[model samples]
Target chain A: MTGGYMGRILFVNLSTGEIREEVLEENICRDFIGGYGIGARIIYDRQAAGVDPLGPDNTLGLITGPLTGTPATTGTRYQAVGKSPLTGGWGDANSGGFFGPYLKFAGYDAVFFNGIAEKPVYLFVDNGKAELRDASHIWGKDTYETEDTLKAELGRGVEIACIGPASEKLSLISGIITRRGAAAARSGLGAVMGSKKLKAVAVRGNQKVPVADKERADRLRSEQIAEMRTPVAGGQSFIERFHKYGTSSGAHRSALSGDTPVKNWGGIGVVDFPEPDSLGGDNAIANLAGRAGCWRCPIACEGRLKEGTGEYRYPAGTRRVEYETQASFGTMCLNNNIESVNMANHICNSYGLDTISAGCTIAFAIECYENGLITRADTDGIEMTWGNHQAIVAMTEKLAKREGFGDVLADGVKVAAGKIGRGAEQYAVHIGGQELGMHDPKLISPRRPSQPSAARYQADATPGRHTQGFGPSGFRGHFLNAAGLCMMGQMAADPTKYLVGFMSAVTGWECTMDELLKAGERIANMRHVFNLREGINPIEWQVHPRITGNPPQEEGPLAGVTADIKAQVYWNLGALDWDMITAKPSRRKLLELGLDDIARELWP
Target chain B: MTSRGSCGLKPDSHRLNTSWYEGSRRGQEWKYCPMFRCVVGVFGLPREVTELREVEIELEDGARLRDIIAALRREIPALEGDIICAGEDRLTDNYAFNINGRFYQDENELQVRPGDRVALLLLASGG
Candidate 1:
């Protein structure tokens, strides 16, 4: 019955070319909640241990949170789940776009895709029905062309998530792009789709999100939109700057605070940063194109930049220059030119790849060449130097295709480092072989807030990163994996401190902060258990040796810093049971966590 | 030339002082940042409130946002809490302060400019 709220879940066995819809067990809803929580369960149950990450066995799932498509201002959030080809760990990446709302409109809580199709196929859903269609023609196209091709085939009303040539080749750092530029990037989940022979997932839904109390959801969303519109933030919030310049606006603040690393940390004069802006940083505003927002979100923090746009006149024009892109392509590569940053972001998006991993691998290559560990003969005879935008752009396209020197950096830092020896691996800063590298958080930097950058390298073992242990107001929080809602919305609404009762009313789960957090924790715990089944080591949670230095520097919060990691915190925090704040995890705690099947599966 | 030069450091440099605006604008910040920055535009008030002395509005902990109205009922009687934060939304206490013309959400130790106005507006949740 609709009374119990079992949003329909559709499963398409691609290898069998069969589509079937099922009513999900109410327990799945109660236990997993929504967003990455449900994503964790789906990946844990459907995926097999030691299954080649780039094979048909690695299931790719599209999921939405319970609050998705509801009256929440930032409610249109979605998640894609699979085993990461990048790190060989469980993959969970989410994005803010119209796809989540459309999934809810299609009258389904989730769509689980498995097995490899005989030919390239795109799954299309309208209202309550789903169909698998041929996508042979659009398979090798770039992300933007894929969407355009799908829209032309399925009508303009459809929303699609598609990959590019890089993904089809099973690149370890690939992503699914939506809204042309927004990415469900990282974790190499796109490789999973490529392996499954899936070209895209397109949907158009007109159905309403079933809410027990529509009035309450409306009131709450209205309240949140109002709270987020103010600007009294001491001009200190990166989110404010994020709205102004995507996430890259934070580069100025972090660099000013001296928390940013520049020119591969090989000492500054090589790239003009040993002294702050003795060279080319303040001139970066020339790259600021404008701002963008996600579906129904009020704080438009997504920046759309290009080189030739108005104030930022470098010919790159408005694409999207987020903070990590700036760090990786600008500071990390010693190419502080704003036009270079804009070009790098566009290159990553067009290639259907993760900007974080792509940037890090290239930076590592530059360092190796600089150290004379690798000669110009090894680098396609082109000198690997920082502040060289032309060299960086050429390499981005090359890496995606695994061509020339690009082939070495194609497998990400961990794998690529193994190929290029001679102390080169030390600077290839990645956590758990996945690159969600440490960056400055708002307010307190690394040391003052004690936010875990040291633990970041270990984050591949965590259930979901980027979405966990972040957001300034929440301080510490997790993503909601139900119908659909973005982390941006979750942070703005203060869900960690406030969404317990609010979520319970809509989903009828009667949730508390402890219960909500437990759901997030249980899902995270399930990820570790799933990764363990695949032979992953839990102790590898650490930052790069280059980052966790000896005689630590003396400037930022991370200045004079060293990391002290604890595996128990990683496991316990996943269950929302930190002994300092919450109760300890007793044997009875295992019983309280429920999911007896999961406990039996993990322990047995 | 932007240094404090011969300008004497005012008492309560961190407090509300409007007369600090009487001298050249370049010499205010002698030690750290010397620029006189304006508050963000989302405060729903005048960007340059020059007439006010020192405006101080206490910030409620973000953990207790729902309680801002009850706290404001006693602190500032000039406006009704219900009007500030409509029944559906609460815009009050989302911001820090104008501390001597510099708009700060929770500036804590940030310095203030002279002849400036401090107005409290809702702090934006930009993430």
Candidate 2:
């Protein structure tokens, strides 16, 4: 491989303590690119159908893209892929930090783990050398402590991705934590790591990722940087704002515009929480101590909050809680305290819980409590009340520890509701067992019944994720993720134009826009196939009524808006070349992407 | 251009000055006598506008935020009708504007002057 990849895949069988290195085929690299694409293809080929997601039969992949370790802006990201315990289908999550770059530097494009270990252990990769070390002392520690301890034992420069108590407890909402706050926080992949008895992956590398053409790579990089600095149509620069306020800058406005789902997707913004500015980016910036960015990224959107003197004081190194976390903990819980939200963020990060799922689960509990379905008797003597920051904080701790009612909620809303009975399931706002992200479908009108609506992506094989394939931009996002570039970097310039240049220069392959989009679509459909093989009927997956405007609000920004989910799904099936009735990819479409084997197996 | 009004006031009551006559020719220079000035905070302009983050310009007696935007478009040229509409009726959905701390989707009729802060907010992707 000329430009982007290290051309090596490390396969480790934890059950037998065997490690093997396999060369990544050039054809596969050219067709799939890297990141999610490589991970999805490997999982589909190696893992058997219907393997228990938390069992040893499931394979866990940690992979980076060709551009990961290069000087490319926002290129430091890695993708984690495995069968999701939450959705029972294809699951993958990506995060930005130093891990991806370091992983590539350690002389491998991807690492796959199979079988369960006899005891807790962590994978240590130093340059080209690899081994599994005993992690008994750090097994029960939180992610922050585990990272610190591992770094102390193996130099400060070594980057680590580790699980916390939530994962160890087998919570379906658990995620792998990296660089303090950066998280592959969706799909419960952390539970897979726990099942394998793998606590962390530590890497330190000194090798440079070979660039195909130095002159062309430098030219493309400089041009892209200059273009990123240029202002766009609306007197605003994506790079500038992202650097200043990160994503939190839009929290207040999004709340006003009905983007942030208020009160567990059951309430409207204006009617439920009128004064949302208190939790906006400006206020978050007011408490900022400094900025923390991923490797080689100029736009340092990660904020470090100042340590407070009182009860809600966050530690100095605490990353600023993002809009999604803020909305989930603040407006979704009816709590307007930004500091409390920050505290909740810290809890989720340290304990390795997905904030969206955790907040939504807690909200479901409150709704159940309000409806008298459950009382303090069900809540371990803690009063689950709306706007009760203290109770919210206490419940989060319990969820991480899997104690009392927290244990019930740890499995996520759908399962928790099923356990409680008494019509409590009606309060659970989720799709296929995964909690929905903060975005409300009703707020933004769907252009087509099946025009890549938010509801459709939420109901996809990897259910309840906001970042799954949605539209052209969504497809581009997938491609960028494959190339190991952050989505934020995509906002600065059109990926179809600029990213292609970077890819061609780095990989020495004349990549076309159509090829890139096709690769992205192939990766998505392959994941869908993973679900279909596992007995998931995509069309049968339900979208929550609250999100579809089943009971329309009397007043608000999205008063009469309802997402036509049936039409939306049908539209999506047609657009993606999937069988409308069965929700499987058409055999013809699979063949087009060079997945003849998949087509034959699926259709036959 | 002839100076209209000039008076140094207390710090608390300080205001900008404008001396442009009605129907003044385009590109005509005006004197600042004593009036109000509006400060447009370009906190998050799109990448096309370069590195500009803040701009201060003298305000007409009945100038609205739209007029200030128009004056800015004239000054930057690259900003013409890209940020604010040519009619100053509405802003593109990609950008949000705040007048004295109040966010507005349509502020064509909203008045402004010097000392008042107009903040431009960017609502792109990422976070």
Error of 1 at A354 (Å): 0.5
Residue A477's lDDT within candidate 1 is: 46
Report the poorest 10 consecutive residues by lDDT, candidate 2 chain A.
A443-452
lDDT of 1 by residue, A68-91 (tens): 777665667788887888777778
Worst 10 residues of 1 chain A by lDDT: A440-449
Please provide, for model 2 over A160-188, each residue's C-alpha lDDT reduced to its tens digit, 9 standing for 90 to 100: 99999899989999999998878998899
Q: Which candidate has the top score in TM-score?
A: 2
lDDT of 2 by residue, B1-127 (tens): 1112222222222333333333324556654444465555553233225344355566656666566555655555555465556654456565655554345555566777656556554433324
True contacts kept of each: 0.01, 0.11
What is candidate 2's CAPRI-style docking category based on DockQ? Answer: incorrect
Taking the tens digit of each residue's C-alpha lDDT, what string does model 1 give over B1-127?
1111011122224332223233334676533223232321112121112112112322212313223233333333333432244342233443333233222333333434432343343222212
Please give the TM-score that candidate 2 achieves against the real structure: 0.84
True-vs-predicted CA distance for residue A555, candidate 1, Å: 5.6
Q: Indicate the DockQ of the complex predicted as candidate 1.
A: 0.04
